[model samples]
Target: MTEPVVIGSERSEVGLPAAMEILLSGGSALDAVETALRRCEDNLEDHYVGTGGLPNARGEVELDASIMIGSSRAFGAVAALKGYPNPISVARAVLEKLPQHALLVGEGAAFFAQECGFATADLLTDEARRLWREALGPSVESVEGENTAAGAGDEAYRAASLELVRRLAPHDGPWGTINVLALDRSGELVVGVSTSGYPYKYPGRVGDSAIAGAGNYCDLRYGGAACTGRGELSMRAIGARAVVERLALGDDPESACAAMLTDAATLPDEFRAELRTLALTFDGRHGGAAGQVGSVYALMTATSAEPEFRARRVV
Candidate 1:
């Protein structure tokens, strides 16, 4: 049997070593993938996911995450979740406890997390809040309360604040996320993704990170794929599923990722430049591509002592 292997989006390096240890210890692919993403979620330095993550325009941290067990194609997801710091674990619990459901959102997701014994915390950190205020500039003080939009009694001020938010929202710029894919020695594949969603987004906004086909897709019979960056474009194109479908058709991992990057290039320049994808085949082949230059991804195998960071192929 082949040794287990794991690959992930660029930021996965923060947790890849631990994930490989899990696989080496005879852990299931699902466990390895989940463990890896959980580590990323705990990395306070990464302002895009879990603890210390950036908040929405309302100054609340809303998270999204998903997990897929390729052997059975079982998928679980949570979106627009608040208070919880580990949406990936919540997603895994959803997969195990809610066999009949594939997704939970907003208050329902939060409720499920609490039922699963997950603790709640104010996910926003001072650093993230500082960044948010920086993006909003001097106009931030004009808005009332935690609301992104202007409250009643200030029509003109509200209009200006809204316009500033539209121009400066993190969704319009570069962002980060974590996608972990594992192939166990027995050939079982599992993929997962986690993110705090775009910074300074409106309340209840959800990105591709929690959406199955858009953020993550896995099929033991084919392979697995995950994506990051301007998630709206990825969701519109079903980006991750398209990459896995290409692998299913017998394309090499690099070819499959490049093909999808090329397709994404046709979108508006802003969206196209922010598009990126990571792919892995059932046989253990893996690669990534990005619409923007200089992007990269990480890879690790059970036999590898450490993760390898490789530049992504640009379309």
Candidate 2:
């Protein structure tokens, strides 16, 4: 039998180091996820998913996060929150308070976070304000170009068309969503995901990051899986958990990830044409492999064996 693996993600602002700290100290997988997520909130880089992430299309900075603990089958999720200090901790609170709740969003989600004793913040910082100001330039330029193209015909119609085009234009990264999965020494599993949704995405839009079984999954009966890259794409394909289910049906982690990626590739050209990539990590043992994309890793422990993490590039 395979030894347990402890997997974690440093997906943008979320700190894998904090989670690693907990797991290495022999803490529970669920606790490690909570601790790590809280640490991410504390970091400036991680500001995108908590108090300092990018604002929505309406110029609001809302957050989304979720967690699943496999050992107890406990789960919690929140979406479109405006000022959560530590979204992962709020998610854990939701799980502890109501294990069966499928989702919570908006002000309700914010209130829940507050009730759980998680701090609230302004949800914007000097950096975010600067970025937003910068984003306005391109949008203004795009509008100016649109007006020129239309050649001064109908004012209202031209303005509307330009606005639509500007909204459709894609910006550069740091991309949204970070996924994590860990299998503890006691054979328990936990999976978590947190993201800023899409940068400049429509307000009130929630991505796969907060959705169960899309960007993250955990199951002792099937191992663990987590996905990063494109939220809309991953959600539509049900990527992460789908990979784990494929593994349960008899496939290695590489093959499973490849299968789901293949499915993603088959998307309609317009959808496939955008910024795209999906990265996956699996920890059958507990501590998963780390490598560039296309690499594969595995681990094994049986009969009083001590745990270890191993890896290799699979072409």
Candidate 2 per-residue lDDT over residues 172-237, each given as its tens digit: 644445555665666677887776776666678887778777866666676667665557777888
Give the Cα error of residue 165 in candidate 1, in Å. Answer: 3.2
Off by over 4 Å in 1: 143-153, 169-174, 268-273
Model 2 CA deviation exceeding 4 Å by range: 1-5, 10-14, 138-174, 269-315
For all candidates in order, the CA lDDT equals 0.85, 0.61
What does the lDDT come to for candidate 1? 0.85
What range of 10 consecutive residues in model 2 has the weakest lDDT sum?
A: 295-304
Q: Best candidate per TM-score, number?
A: 1
For model 1, how does the per-residue alpha-carbon lDDT over 1-315 read when each residue is reduced to its tens digit? Answer: 868889988778888888888888888888888888889998887889998888887678999999998889899999999999889999999999998999999999999998889988888888787888788777676654565654465676666665665666463333687899998888899999999987777778888888888989999888999998878888888999999989988898888988987776676754233778998888888889886678888888866878988788887
User: Judged by lDDT against the true structure, how good is candidate 2?
Assistant: 0.61
RMSD in angstroms between candidate 2 and the native structure over all alpha carbons: 6.4
* Clash number by candidate, in order: 0, 10
TM-score for each prediction?
0.93, 0.77
Candidate 1's displacement at residue 304, Å, is 1.7
